[model samples]
Target chain A: MSGIQDFVVLTLVKAAPLIYAALAGVVCERAGILNIALEGQLTIGAFTAVAVSFATGNPVIGLLAGVVAGALVGLLLGVAATRFGVDQIVAGTGINLLALGGAAFGLTVVFGQPGASAEVSALGVPGERGLIVGAFVAALLLHLALYRTPWGLRTRASGENPRAVRSAGIDPRNVRLIATMLGGALAGLGGVYLSLGELDLYSDGMTAGRGFIALAAVIFGRWTPFGATGAALGFGALAALQFVLQRSGVPSELMQALPYLAALAALTGIAGRARAPQADGVPYTE
Target chain B: MIRGLAIGLALALFAAAAMLLAGANPLLGFWALFRGALGGVPQISETLVQTTALLFPSLAVAFAFRAGLFNIGAEGQLVIGGLVAGVIGARLETSGLIAIPLLLIAGSAGGAAWGAIAGVLRARFGGSEVIATLMLNIVAALLANYLVVGPLHSPGVAGPETAELPHSSWLPALLPGTRLTVALLIALALAFVLRWVFARTVFGYELRAVGDAPEAARRAGINLAKTAFVTMALSGAMAGLGGATIVTGVLHRFNVSLSPGYGFIAIAVALVGDLDPLRIIIASFAFGILQSGALSMQALAHVPKDVVSFVEGLAIVALAARRFVAGRKQMTALAPE
Candidate 1:
């Protein structure tokens, strides 16, 4: 019984960050900006959280700083896509490279070393539990806000038909920019959970493609807030299973690959013929 | 051309700012970078080797972009190709003449198969190639790690790499002592061939029509699904062949860390070259200088070598505008009145 309880706890702990990132994807794609920069946002958030924590010795402030940093990176993507008319995928790829390179550079500058930073103040276990609960709360709130609010209608309408939003006297670009920022903030908090809630220090590649995994969760969830959270929890359970089955002679690499493999399988219509938002990844031009 | 020059200047400025932030002299960093990349015969040869390594994937990326498909899984395809080549080369005992072509073909086939997975998904299921390719990249890495380190582990090898290929399987050297080999010539010939194909082939015209105006191409009776599958497979073959060359010519074995994001960087190269196969060779050389010079820049200038990638990332964002404008122009030109 205790083992079952522990597994449940571990699943929530693992799923927290993925839930945040998947939510980020849901919001951005729903608003017509395919935020391929979610990985970059996560990287920046994790790095900034650690750097600020190391500087001020306050984990909470680091948390806030991380969210703001992520939002700024999201803003960069929004401006480039909406204002400069840059290809979103290209811009997202660029941002991923930039965030990775910038963080590696930052490690040398801030920590006076490469590869990792020294152990710093962390949010501890209670904070971690709080975040796990907050993830569920966030999902519920997103579901409500997306389906029940006027802003949600505008955001969804923008994704389905941005020209219609424009005809209604609201610039869809602003709507997209705002959605990206909100999504970025959520993803930033996810990063904070990884660095602060689970670990005490920052290491290069610590995020370890979790950002990409979150992308899979988004698709599996069919681009809905509650649905994405549920998919994230399933992935989290798989991660927990990996830990349990590590000593059972099963290769961990294969285990680590299950989500990606599932995503590939999903592309074959095994998951469903669920359609994405019409204007998703399509840049709206004036 | 002017846009390329401006982007170069901007990258230089960004590099300088990064140096300043790192407490290094920007001038010293620049000097070290150029000196390391072009100082002597050895340095230049090393730069060319880097150039050769980058060329295959850059051209592969340009190929798919011309077909309006983003083949982001070049990294994965390259790994699978190298893995197949390395595994086959390790065991095959034959004359160099026979072994080289066989191994290269195997590598290309491996990459094409990997690429065809995404192609099938897009062609049959009407799925997004972006997500499929992205997922495949991770799967490729994991599969390579499993194969090399587990069942296919090379005897007497301590690391997660295959046994070195027999000497007969090795690609003949172009420069006796340097790592540069006939692979450079092969890559150059491929670029010329690709240029001709794009300019003069009926298939090329069909591909361009699909990329520039998909609806119109469909109306013209072009098979969009078949074209997507074929283009992706061919793109993957180019990247796979690049991997095979690396295994046979450079490393003589496959290691899981075969590419350091070359596939992703190839996107920048393709875009910078304006998706022109011939011009990608030039772009590859420019990026190659950075790849070879970064180590020296770190050692001598105390600047982080990551500055190169950072600047490359900035360059991608800045240059992406060009692709957008070009794509828009093509669409407008082909739009029905």
Candidate 2:
């Protein structure tokens, strides 16, 4: 029981970033935007957060920097997809490539390293109860904001039938931009949790495809915040179990593949039913 | 064509800028990079051989893209194809004449089966092929790792790699004094065949129609389900062939690190190629050159080879960003009907 409890604890901690990222996707997608840039945003955010924390020796500062970095990318994507009427998917892909390239370039320009940023000053902040609690509270709050507010109603309306809402005299494009930027901030927080809270270092490809899995969670959870977070936790549990089970006679390589398989199962199991925002993958106007 | 040339020019400028920023003379770096990639007979040979790997996988991706499916699982297909071919080629040393073709067939069959799994799910269950294939890639990768580590640990070999393949199973060399094998010719021939099938067949026409508009394709009495299955199966077969050739032709042994995101890069190649087979051959070589040049760039500039990744990233970002600027809907509307 203790061992199980320990695994659960570790799993929830690791699950924090995934939960944030999935909900981030959910937020943007709820506003009728598919945020495929989540991966790139997370990667750049992690890189920046780690870099800032290293430079400033403050985790809070790093967190803020991460959010800012993510929001910058979000702003570009939002403008491209909304104001410019670009295909949101392609714009998102651009964001990914840009972020990936930007991070790599930054690494080279700043530290002259390839795989990792210079050993940064580590942040011990949110190392325990604060981190897990932060995710749950966020899930609850985002769920509330998404369902229980008039603004939320407008946002949902924008996603479902934006043309109708646009005729109602509100700019759906503005709403989408806000939604995407907020999602970016949340995703940036997830990145901070990785580089600052857990590992205290930044490495190349450190998100390790978690952001894509978070997209899968967004699908698995059918675009709901809590559901997405739940799915994220499920993935995190499998990930944690892979670590735990590796010690119990399983080959390390086999364990390495289990999280991906579990993610696939989760994606396929719920994909047919993972309804998107009616306007998802479509550029919004007005 | 003009746009592509402009893109190449922009990328050249970007590469030069990157080189200068890395504290190396941009001219010197470009000289080394270009010379390394396309300088001589030897260099060109290496570039083409690498292009052989990139072309097959990219074509695999481009074929699936034509069906509105993104198969990021080429890595898995490549590994499984290689593993089956390698294991069979080395271990099942029965008759060379029989075994060589059999290994290729078996390897491709393994890749097709793996690819078809995602196709089946997408076709019948409406599962996202992207997720399914990508996950399967990791699964296949680890499976290869397990095979190398446990069962195929190469007859007293300490590391996780298979033993040398039987000489008879090896692919015939395409050139003297180079590792270039008959696989290049085979890949080129298949690409030509793919082009013919795409241009001439009812199947290919329907594939285009389905990709253009799925519901419209169905309205035209085209069997949407059939198209999905066949296209995915064929796409998987291409990637499978990619894997098999590497085993019997290139590596001749299943190594776990046999690929480094070759599958994802292939997606970029497919897109940049505009999903045309002839264009894919060229696009594959372009990327092959980038990869080949990257190593030399690292050695000359003391910059890591990942700098090439930045350039690749810049190119992808620019291409996708072009959609955001020139914009797809605008161009579609402007085109003369």
Give the whole-model CA lDDT for all candidates, comma-separated: 0.88, 0.76
CAPRI-wise, candidate 2 is acceptable
The residue-by-residue lDDT of candidate 1 on B1-337, one tens digit each, is 8877987998899889999999999999999999999999888988988888889988888888888777878988988999999999999999999999999999999999999998888777777777888888889889998998999998899888899999999999998898899999988988999999889999999888778777788789988888889988999998999999999999999988988888888888988888898888999999999999999999999999988888888888888873533432233223122
Choose the strongest candidate by DockQ. 1
lDDT by residue (tens digit), candidate 1, A100-169: 9998999998898999999999999998889899999999999998999999999999989999999999
10 residues in a row with least lDDT, candidate 2 chain B: B328-337
Stretches of model 1 off by over 4 angstroms after superposition: B322-337
Candidate 2 C-alpha error for residue B332, in Å:
20
Supply the DockQ value of model 2. Answer: 0.42
Q: How far in Å is the alpha carbon of B133 misplaced in model 1?
A: 0.7
